[model samples]
Target: MTAKPPISALTDHLGYWLRLVSNHVSASFARRLEAEGVAVAEWVVLRVLYDVDALAPSKLAARMGMTRGAISKLADKLVAKGLVDRADDLEDGRAHTLELTKAGRALVPRLAKLADANDRAFFAGLTAKEREGLKRLMERTAAQLGLDDIPVS
Candidate 1:
């Protein structure tokens, strides 16, 4: 009988290591956001709206690399939370635009600080240069892989 080739170990793949780190990082951030009464997905929406005065849901969806339906659902939740306002577009009565409310705008900076803290806690061992290099490498890898999906979770 012919001997079978040995199977590769789970840790042999680069993806395994990446996923291990990603899961931890994402879970940590999610918990922080939850404490602030926002989901990771909601934070993504609010972060995108931070600099913009208003935008169509279609445009926002495009920017977020998410489906319009998903954006609409998220918008509904934000609206109910008093974090976003949905209004008719003056240029196109049939269309609508979304803008962050005063409360939403106020919360963004605080959330941003939380994000910063989370990153710092997770990457405290890395020097500034090391952090930048790691970020650049990840960006290059994502670009090479055509990873356009915005990380909502």
Candidate 2:
């Protein structure tokens, strides 16, 4: 049999750490969102629509890293729930724009609070400096990945 490659450093590799942290973060957020009667993807769509007055479907799809078809399904669900509305774009008859309805706008702040609470619950033991370090490191990595232009607001 051929000699097997040795495991150099599986325990503390950067990718391993990233995946572990990300998985925990995502799973925690998913649980938090479930309690609020929303799925993670739905929250992502609502959160993105929270800040803007409205955006074209194409723009929303691009920003959310989802296909237009997927965005449409999400939008449809939101629309059914009376949290969002879609209307034809004034400038482009064939295209549509989406906006959070009054109820949706109202729901966003509560969801934001849920998000904050989830973060606090997950990182309460960490010192402020550690949190800041993580934020800075994440920001630097995002910048390095040329993802700084995506507005989180």
Model 1 residue runs over 4 Å out of place are 1-4
Cα lDDT over the full model 1: 0.92
Worst 10 residues of 2 by lDDT: 144-153
List, in order, the clash count of every candidate structure: 0, 0
TM-score list, all predictions:
0.92, 0.89
lDDT, residue 70, model 1: 94
lDDT of each: 0.92, 0.83
Predicted candidate 2 versus true structure: per-residue lDDT over 12-123, tens digit per residue? 6899987787788778888888887877788877888887888887887788677889878988988998999999888878998899999989998898888898889878
